[model samples]
Target: MPLHPRPRALPTAFVAVLALLLAAGNGTWATTGAGAQDRAGSAPRPAALAGRVIVTVAGQQDAGRAAARAEVRARRVYRFALNGFAATLTEKQAARLANDPEVVGIFPDRTVSVAAQTLPKGVDRVDADRHPGAAIDGVDRGVDADIAILDTGIAPAHADLNVVGGKACVTGDATTRDIHTHGTHVAGSAAARDNGIGVVGVAPGARLYAVKVLSDSGGGTISDVVCGLDWVTANAATIDVANLSLAGGGPDGACGQPTTDPFHQAVCNTVAAGVPVVVAAGNTPGAGRDIASSNIVPATYAEAITVSAFTDFNGRPGGGGAAICAASGAVDDVFAPYSNFGADVDIAAPGTCTYSTLPNGGYGYKSGTSMAAGYVSGAVALYRAQNPGASPDAVRAWLLGTAQPQRSGFGFTGDKDAFAEPVLSLGDGSFPSPTPTTTATATASASATSTATAIRTATTNTATATRTPTATRTPTATARRTATKTPTRTPTRTPTRTPTRSLTATPTRTPTANTTATATATATATAFVSTPPPTATVVTATATATATATTGTTAAPYRVAASGRSANSNSSLYLYDRKPATVWISNPATTPPTVAFAYLDLGSAKPIGAVRWLVGADGTADSFRVQVSNDRATWINLTANPLANGPTGTWHELRITTTARYVRFYVTNPNADPRIGGFAEVEIWP
Candidate 1:
């Protein structure tokens, strides 16, 4: 693993001899592959450049070229500028030529292969959705950034992915379209478009370029990989990020010196050009432990932002669906079973059953650290796009600093240092303006108005309006029921007993016979059960309790946003209007769509007790799940089963126990009429 000395210069005598041989036309080497040979009369075939081995020579560029040409018909690929030239030569010829003083080493072109590998959750988990300018003019705007994927090419026409352009290092023609799905999938994970038909990527707006080092069979060699890296380096200024999902060979200490490992050297040069690299922490299927020391190439390379996989078994914590593996407790953000981990891993992302784009116009699922690295690549693109002048070090710092701390029990069994790998948590790009105080103030006013309305109704209806403070305060079970059916009148009845206590008196003074009993009944009933306006006194008390469920809690109104919504009347804004009567309905087109998700960004992390929902007067989803996320990506499910009890015109409150900056309500399945979904309002409890 020790560093090797730099390549040495060739002898002047050897160079002269090689020049003489080339001048005498004594070096005639045939090319390899289909249609590689020149016509009988055509100028003697130029050295085959395709599929040629990159020969590292101990000489100056001109001398190395002269020596290679003298020994065999060689078409230079790298031009020996980096002390190496890819040339066409048979195994026997290469072996014979190695004895020359100018030729230092002859390595068989090793075939590198594509490493086979999502989504709003992964995007939100990394907080890419929170990136500044994510949405502009009513549409989600992608960052103006570019990333290169060095794999099995890409399908630029894939509907969900946007590939700018790329080069192929494979045999024959130079087309970068994906022959294998690996590169396509990796590309999708990193920058699939935000178009509604397929999955959205972590940075859906970034331009993607493919460096096809791997062939259709998912195999290529070290030389091919270096070729791809060289291309990436050549255009580093245009590519802010690069992701290498493929990994080969075991680690042999630190990234070896350039003289010993051209791959490392190429990657080093690429990073030096200001483009950050992300690579997969290679997988170890049955071992269930760290493989960092296995000498994984790009991953172990010091410049890479190595990423490991975490199995978001249920997509969100506490939620359930098909799992990548059997995992229990705190499974949402657990480390993936097959992921490699160790000191080298820089971070982790959801890689289990990640959904993304595929080649030939389709989409599919794959799981691996390859997918995880793509997510990081996308994250880096977002960061670079937002901070165009940021250096590689600054980008890495921001990425690492904002990562969410990992829990030890979350399925990770790697070294303690590996377990500490931070789960990526891209913070909201900017602090949201604090919600207006008028929002809460309005809720208080509504409570008071409802109470007054109820009392006035009582005054016009029953003589009990004049009952004693104690008598009016103690409502019998039957009376409470009637009060609920007419909530407006209920509060009036309570204060009737304390008219002497003043109509503006606190409602709690007239304690119900059993607060627990009242809560038990109302808690189970849909919020839609028509109730008289709550007396300002009692409503204030209940609201306070709901808001203060967590100690030192601060309740702020949230900004509502939906993946799909109807016209302006039912827009997402209505969800936060503090009026249970005002509703926000989804567009009919989104009913059974792939992702039926709506969210509220609270601007800042807050502890929430319950989420209140008013199912639309039109219809409600048969079942839906609520999830929470600090970064808006790695959502934690707050419920065990999707709630399906709401009927049209009913109000339901799901009691959740978690703290997050964003909360999402996802419809798991459509109703009888899938396209007919609606919601009157969604409220976060204080």
Candidate 2:
């Protein structure tokens, strides 16, 4: 039978946009990895260990001789929701299909950069434009272009983001309505209309194409993701940018990595054909690599622009509404509470307390690097809308070309303003080599007083107190259980002729010999088990000097800082600013309680937000704000902090972290004040 103009909704469990991802998720990815690879030829290439995706052919391949040819090529390959093809091809089979003219293309299972958006300070409630929607962040906000946000799904009914071009994969019995609130939220961040409604997108007028990758629960593999990429690459002519707010087990985000990896390769394929693939970095901090290092996959590739997340200080609920999403603090990329972060993270953007559209037909708030990445996607659309003839490389050069310099702070902390250059002010690409130049910006006060904005002219100012990042090489996994015990063994032996004048009679090994042999065998097995194999688990963070903000002194049990408060269910882990303190109770039955502050700093956030399992030991199990007298010995902050409740669910702790010496303590009041708890690193920027 011949095919029709458009393929009907096949009853097969193919990949359609899963329910718009309502659950989630940036870094601004930037680099030219070609030089890096050329230099790294001696080193073995990083293992391609991303989860798998299968390719199908109309026919099967022959084994020994006269192999069969692929009769028909698949139009698109799906990922996340739609999974497992009937045809499981080996490397050779896959090679054959890749080379086949009839075959379309082999795609990866999922998009790189699943951890793009950092979880916002507020986990429970979310809505776009908490206050006013004005573009006062030094960037022109109005423009139109074509952008496709492939995620869970979107809510077309949302007043703010009246997105056009909404469609789902609708492969199976799934009615193809937005199930997860994710897709709608992401789309709203990217393409929400400028109409006086709820939220304002980065590029409000930009055309939208909703593409679902993950399912409603927000779990997905790689297949459906590849299908969405294929669609973008094929439709590059119509699409100025394709915002992929998803990642697999590996790297890349909101934009595909330029180097390799299936997703990044697809991004490269699109780049070759003049399209840009934007991706999300993911939600795992410290779990990923450093912002400039290895937390790899496509997002880290040179071509992609990974966007990190931040809270909207301008849109603080009842205050002024925000236009372009932006945060005003040094903890910009300080890792959203739940966002996964690492060195490969490129840049950061607004993600906290974001309100957007849902596919089913309503609106909601989404907090993750996913929201930040959407801002970049919309920005790209606007840029391409203005400069349609710009090359992929040119666009890449321009984004980083005009990116503001965000310095990584001291002590394994992440970077906030790494890509903090205002978009409108950014239009030039100067850094053509490994050494990127930093454009200056204003270091504004919390009150946002009218200060002299840091002007970044064509002047060369390398007078930077930038701390060179140091790599820590502690093996992530400890030794596994080694079996050690005496065991009985059986052995067979034959005696040889002695070197005496006469041949010696052989003593046959009997029951006693068997027992000794058994002991030897057991010892050998124990020794073999004792040795550990090399399982790589690298922890990435760049904590340098971070200046805590002195949020005006407040009373106890407050949610003032949004983050850093124990009273609230979730605390924003970005800034070092002091949060209102709550009380913690001491009970004989219950152990001491401590507040959590993530140390993930820099362009991307870090992991190590919460300490290990609670323990009696004070040092390892507490959260601290150190009062650095000299950078070495420090005092513990948050001591005797007030608590909101009886410390059943959790306790509230707050401290005013600053640039110089200050009164700092830990969350522990029962413990000696001389003994400080712990402090996860935060960040400061240029």
Candidate 3:
């Protein structure tokens, strides 16, 4: 079976754990892979199809020993020599080929993704200074980009939250505020506006749409996480990205993770839709490898942009590396005392003294992988803000391509996490154009096949709303990538590797409160499909990056109020909670991604049983919807050619389910010639 979308890429944050947990710093992030696949709909390219045929001295370090020693000596395209294997491939690439028994598995040349983290300084209440770097730099401007935080809910009115729209999957509260401020904290870090008095955010100008999956008390079910993603899919209009600051389960090493988990699939779906998601590494070191097991859920979801936490020092005296800190045992992922370490980790960030948003009129400090995720989310916004023409995958590639290489332990081995600090750098939005060696190496070995991963076809209604992903691969210390020598392969145990490192510098001040000024929306008319697309052309321009947000809340003036009613099909703005309507003005380019939200009246609001539609008025069979009442039992809902009905109406196709929780099956199947469609939330009360 092809790997489903559910499998999450290792959290970039895990890399931080490696940076923190281990001594000998100087490790960097790795290069990101391509292809935006949805766990539920798309599948990892067939190992047979996506893989290539390449002979190598994999999993046999002994032949390996001669070959390994020889390869290293020749340096003719060589990498680190792990214990059991010595093939050439990235951690992700190596994991992709782990099943080939006869050939042996490859390993990443120090590939990284995520890291362990520290509690942030918490959202502080300070005033912003506009002079020079006094303002938020490298932050995502306030362009209405949907950001999802899979942690505790946000305090809807936190001065620092700058939250314009949100939905709680665990609490089922789409209206008012949430009790917990986890989401607010994460959201604030990724995109709090830089109003003069408040702390600036990474992407201050971006319009943040919060999707609350976890509960007020903190943790939540896998089902709620999945629903939260689904809700984001339905309302892409207001969201361009998502932040997942939580995880479940412990390490399941080696095979990476399975692609069949529902929560994994839901997150993959968002990525496939061209939206980027950021997830956290687990706070606890995984089950096995000291700090190996990664938190499940979004962290393991293949498409999420995972992050790791980093501190200011390099766990050693007078020995701080660039981005590596001293006394790291206390803070930071690179030297983070408690971060989970392994191939799944992607990148590291300043997690301590971090400031964003919090629950009440109150804000306090707490450390964990969550704070690290926020830092990455902020950087992702800047990447998008700088390159609107970049595809989600391409954007991912750019982030990875620019990461400074990080090393592990005493050896400079493996690839870096997919992303690292100084987060965004511009890149031509393009896929890896056929690398003969690298491409072919990924091909499946002609070995006996076993279960790739299970895909349960549960009753659409019977499946859990969100299912935590599981990894069948038994946790293996071998997968952790510590710089160990062959023969004994004992993990390099050095005095510097002590877990009890101290914090050299004190934590930074708390973050400032939110105070986004209200500004009018400005729409621009540019072509998105044009070759070398316009330079970050603004559809709703005012919402630029995090810094500008505090200056003013300028975005498309549109919203769906509490009492608004919709019949069969109606595309609404995912971020718009107001009563106005704003049609995006970007010219057609590659399939234009969009999202919107609406209320399902069922029978209460007299929406008299209607089906919903979003594709071109008459373009059915191209883009379609799969309907589900309970959100679990899903069936296809096709759009009949207008054939003379309301511009966009429901009920013309499939029917007889429930009246509430209706959502259209929206997609941009094609990539060329930008496709246009609107998302509509409707109810069919027959």
Candidate 4:
């Protein structure tokens, strides 16, 4: 006989809102006596409530068994974010659980929906396009951070995204693949790669982890959402940031201690684990407009960064642009008409007509506070890349601190609540250099010694001449070839000859004792026409003298006074340190078509023959140029064209003949792999 499989557990009912309103206890209960009747009779029991309820336990215990002890079937158990479980329970069963001292509170499971309606220009609206590290253009350089999208699963096959991994918490869904198109759209807005394809995201190329909480219909219960949060908290070490573009209706109140709001408690726990959460201020349906505190969940939680929506048709700050959604009454540079607003909202971002990737390798527009939250999530990723270990509170502070305030020309005209929240802006795209840990030093020694030997032969044929004792001389035909090549070779010989002539003249000025020295000098000078060996020797001597004339200068080895990023005092001494493992890296440019530069300042001007560097662990540069500057103000390129196709973990050498006080390395188009451009070691040879 074949056995039948057990039925899958499901929620009994889906409520619209789950409010947290604790009631005073009536009396103690005794299971074996009339006291139990008195306790049950004291409170006016509402007609047996039956549905799926979320039970928040007081401590970290077995949540599933806790529900079982109350005679309910647990559908899901949450461990990391909240010590709780979701179970199907009747009124008496839920009441019995509430009486247990270990149980915190029990509330009905509510519905949650995706907050989206979307675009690429939202990236520009947040000024992420202006940041070099953002790489908003279709460049390969990706943000070096991971972002988790908690929504209806992402499209696993989306070509434009770097979907690393995911987890599915919704019922009957084994994979975190988007069938609803909402989570995929949200993922694209947060970090679609800048691969010159369909569209780019705010934080281009950040690793995306899909945490599927909602289902294909773009809806799910609070239990499903909490299940996703539990997964996020468990993997908090790998996730740098999280984006929640979904919302639910609920009473606004503080979580923990006196009150028990499971959703808010889960969000707080997630933030405390170091992963910053960015959430959307919900959208009101139809023509209804309400403050965010009225219906938005997680938005009311102070632990997360709540984002409001603003319309930007032109991707700029000024008003008067054409409205894309005239039906919704959206005006350019103003708060989106359908967005929820109130003191709970932390910031605003572009959410109108957001162009982004959709399911099945497609792309389209979505409009909602969900899109706004995505922009903020991308910005948070950029920050996390620069500050790897920043706390959630620190991330929030930096984001708000760098934002463009309404008073500073980013203000929108029509917020119903009149709250002047700062608008997001990725300022200048430059970040503070990482603190120095260890120092590495490089000592370059270069010496050129040229030795020349000249032999002149003469033959005379004697023929008797009566009066003058003169002999008819037959000249012997002699041919000689000599070539001398020094590591430091200048293309122009005119300047070299001038210095050679002056040095020769000085030796000839000496009196009788220096007569032979003058002849030898003349012979070396004459060799400039027939042979370059002697001339090269004289030029090398002259170069040595000029180098010695400067203070703190040495003959062959050159000493570097300092090294750092161009036009910045932040020390990049690791570049000069001989250690190949130590590196000085720059944050990937938020925007593309920009350069990241670092410079080495020699104690004084010296001849630089070649620059050798080892590619850092982050990755290799796509193209680079070597520049020389006599004064740090003006620079001349030593390499006419950028060196391309750099290999990883290998030392690359660019041979050039130039003399300067400072040498700079410019990564014009950095490799998109690691995004952060840097060199492990740099050696400048004389």
lDDT of each: 0.51, 0.36, 0.35, 0.59
| Global CA lDDT computed for model 1 | 0.51
lDDT per residue for candidate 3 within 1-686, as digits (tens), equals: 01112222221110000011111112221111232222554332212112111122333334334333323221121121111222334335434443333223221212112222122222121111221212344342343333555455556666655666666555345533556555666666666665543455555645565565555554444334455556666554335566665554422232322221223434545665556666665555422122223334335444555555544333221223343223234532233444444445555554544554566654444455666666566656555544442345444443443333243221122112322222121122111122122111110001111111123255742322222111111111111112221121111212111110110112222222222321121111001111011111111112122112231112111111111112222223211211112221113445443421122212122211223222123332233333333232332221211111123222122211123333333333343224333322221222
In candidate 2, what are the lDDT values of residues 416-477, reduced to their tens digit? 32323222112121211222122212111111111111222356421112221221211111
Better of 1 and 4 by TM-score: 4
Among all candidates shown, the one with the greatest TM-score: 4
Q: Give candidate 3's error at residue 49 in angstroms.
A: 34
Candidate number of the best lDDT? 4
Candidate 3, backbone clash total: 153
Q: Order the candidates by TM-score, highest first.
A: 4, 1, 2, 3
* Between candidates 3 and 4, the TM-score winner: 4
What is every candidate's alpha-carbon RMSD to the true fold? 24.9, 26.2, 25.7, 24.3
lDDT by residue for model 4 (76-135), tens: 888888898887787688667756656666666777767651236677777777766675
Question: If the candidates were sorted by their lDDT against the true structure, best first, what order would they fall in?
Answer: 4, 1, 2, 3
> Backbone clashes in each candidate structure, one number apiece?
29, 142, 153, 25
Q: Global CA lDDT of candidate 2, please?
A: 0.36
